[model samples]
Target: MKTAAAAGEAEFYLEPMIVTAARYDNSAGKPGYYKVDEKKLENGNYDNALDVIKQLPGVTLMARGASGGMNAYSKILLNGSDRYLVIIDGVRSNWNGSSYNDFDFSVLPAGMLESVEVLSSAAGSVYGNAAKGGVIRITTKKAVEGVKTSINLETGSYGREQENILHLGKSGEWSWSVYARKSIMGDYSSARQSIPSYENVENAGIKLTKAWGETADLTLSYSVFSGRYKSKIFNYKNTEPDETKPPKLFKNIFMTDARKTEDNLTLEYERKFSDTENNIVGIYRRSSNAAYDRSLNVERPWLLDLRTEGFFDRYSKQWHPKHTLTGGVEYYKDQVLDYQDLAAKYSDGTVISKAVHLQDSWQLADSVKAVGSLRQDWNSYAGSKLSPALSLEY
Candidate 1:
């Protein structure tokens, strides 16, 4: 990864070192990618983000507890319908929740990431109606010109340990980026965040990108979270924790809590439309949230989330020979308010998950290539689906 005129000059390569092309970490390098970093979830015994996708490849990360209260909601099945899609830069983590916010991935901010891409499927004809079980794009960290900083500290074992983190970048041209993260983990009746159970969180994020002339560019982002957990029906002497299965390894006695807050906003664009290829993005996101479960003390089972998403694309990186083409169009809007705090409360409902997409890819030589896609989902009353797919790469 060189720029700024080949940065530091560390030549030790034969091939494969180039790094950026706007793809970021592509997680496990395609074929169901999995890139998770943060010292691999702070070492020993993970308990969130499905323990880092349960270690990649055809992923699976079922949980009942490990930190964070609440369970069941992460069913990312691709070939069998479950529709999984999450976007940090575009903010679209809605695919019908309950999977505990599907891939909490520790509510993001993995020390201010710079890459995290997981596709799970050739994208089933491209981003349409929640990506039909695949798409996790996260590219954080921008604003660079000078003054860069980062610091992190960690400790292990139950009643685990952690220290604050800070990353800052600045250089003018109206550039700025800031991040702060706090973590507290523990709850191992013998293994993994043991608590009256375990979990403690405080997170913050901010980003700004500028450069108004040249070709065109603008960006702004924000993230905030506050969480406290230990409650899962106060552990109820370790009983039900089913999504598929899991609940035995040394149980946690009892305790309760759940606090939440999530925010997101982004706007971006790039242009170059007349070279060999270029006409990148036009992204947008606005997410809202509020959740509370003070050990069932009150607040009437709170959970409120409002959403918005959109992305327009036209990317082609190859002129001839082996090819590259990413066709895209995606949109989503959701409004949900769930309050079941009992003792008399508020209940609201809203569901409108929409989708429209197209895909293309043809290369026949090089490594071998062929891909196709078409997706449509519009709901005035549940009726729309036309998925076509084929994949090969070797």
Candidate 2:
């Protein structure tokens, strides 16, 4: 019998694998990464994406005001820190460059998400300065071989109602997916203050992909979310004569109205040179607008309008027997179009950033693996910095 080497073929055939759990889908696998797939999302019946994100280990959810839902304040703490990067369909979604602002989840439909991956470890080395705490990646559903559609309608206590629709199909060399969702939260009394609040949200997204020869593909996607809320709060007031008798305080109800809208557009191209090599290039733009009206409490209404645009490229190659190398470049510009508050009108300006990163994964032994990454970033406003990270798994 002839030896397999005599056949003049590669020793082992490359088998494609679908990985939705790892930190980098095509890069080295890291520990402490968790993935919530479509099956889990449906079986859990979560109200929103945030609810599903809360179930992950090392993650804590905190909210204020209207139970952290729409029109309220909510944030996620990963590994004891609230600073983290959020990526939706390969596009950055941070309204504020610093990640300290409230992250609105009302627009993310649980039924439309294909998977949510969380890397709880500090990953600045590969994701840049914004990923000090970790990274949260959300992947929307996409068409496969055939067409599929789903509809979800739900009602809950406090007069909450939600509806979601998803349509996905693949025909010839083109694939497409569309999603729409609406949520209405009726007046509900807060547990602490018994304040009544109402909220409504609307969200929609569409993705289209065109493939050529199974080696290259182009994808375009767009998403929009709008949400508004109204709530009444009691303010205390004291009269001159009231100070004489126990300082009688009068309660005044003030109505507050807040609205927010976000939009994202992205275009990406990917080419596969082989099973072990590939490259991706993409461009994206994201914007968010927020307005708050509280005439009774403040003299002027508050508003914030922010927009960001960026480009990114990444290449992955396996050049050695035990090594896989990945390199990437990123450039982004963040601008505050309009900003105003009770104190003053915050200056409107723009901040730009350019960064490059390299990663190496080594299969040290049969049961041992190591991954190391380094990133250099230059920010127009904050100067430059270098970040490095290393991990070993057995």
Candidate 3:
């Protein structure tokens, strides 16, 4: 009786679709080098480059406070040495500019990074003695095919707040990326502080690139960071009013009023002669200035100024199916303009350095490789030296 109603039944089927992402790892070409995974960096939500560096194997970070805090003084020690090097987008960031100051990792925000590469073992041949302890290479974000924008905001205790914005776009052969960030701590109090401190930081940067087909490209990048902080200040009174009381100097503890500004500018050009050959030329400059007033209600001011300029030319060629050769020449000059200290004698000085290096990588077998490098360096103060290294991987 109901057979007419059961005649209309239908079935549908769907197939699965899979998507994959591609990532590049340049560490294979450099002995003793390792790259932090892109997926891990994206998911870690780290605040600054210092946090990521702290998690690497055979790395130790010694600091006074939090890694990126205003009151923090950090020293990156690798394999028990503090002579490591830091590079950002193919530009050297540290070891050439400041005399008494270390590279403050707090200035480098994590949201603007694309990748981080680390060399834990000695890399003296490729990067000179500055990399004796290790090397940290950082690459900033690049523009994609289309327009994109992102924003991040964070809040925490001690009246901490941070905001970051990044925008990227590409049109035809021109692409650019711009970013800005701000971090503030209105009231930071430590166990050793009787009063709260305040800090403010501002950072902004832009990178522009022009590509001529796939064989050549030119890039210009500039970034600046400004930070101001006032440390905990309180008064200590002599309740017993005696000349023998040693002048109650407790107020001088953690009392600081300082501001610092740092900027970096880099220009780079790359051309590919063929699929197996290429070359790069880069010029970079970096500077830092700081002003401090240690005494409250006093106008005494001290200034510290440092500057560095560098130029480099590098070439790469694949001579055979399994052999690759690379060579480079580098020049750098550093100057200290207005640095002064009572305990340490620091005066105006300029240092010039020149270096030449060559490296070869050979494929010994389907799954084995060998690399060798030699470098000669000339310094204005430290004299000249030759460094050689060899490594094998299977």
Q: lDDT values of the candidates?
A: 0.56, 0.76, 0.74
TM-scores of all models?
Answer: 0.29, 0.80, 0.79
The lDDT leader among the candidates is: 2
**Model 1 alpha-carbon miss at residue 25, Å:** 46
How would the candidate models be sorted by lDDT, starting from the highest? 2, 3, 1
Q: Tell me the number of clashing residue pairs for each predicted model.
A: 16, 0, 0
lDDT of 3 at 101: 33
Clashing pairs in 2: none
lDDT score, residue 342, model 1? Answer: 32
Stretches of candidate 2 exceeding 4 Å from the true structure: 1-30, 64-73, 99-102, 120-122, 190-194, 231-255, 319-322, 363-369
Candidate 3 lDDT (Cα, whole model)? 0.74
Best candidate (score: TM-score):
2
28-103: candidate 3 lDDT, tens digit per residue: 4544556776567789978777788788765787753322222334676776777677777777777542334357
Candidate 1, number of clashes = 16
Instruction: Kindly list the per-residue Cα lDDT of model 2 for residues 1-394, writing each as its tens digit.
Output: 7787887765877899887864534222435567888777889877677787788877788654333212354667776777777777666676534543456665676766789888644445555566656788888876788999889888998779888888889999999988899888877665765556777878898989999977998999999988788755445566547545777567876777888788889999999999889998999998888777656685677677888899999889998767999889999998989888656798578999999999888877655668898888999999999878788866
Give the lDDT of residue 147 in candidate 1: 66
lDDT of 3 at 24: 61
Q: Can you list the residue pairs that collide in candidate 3?
A: none
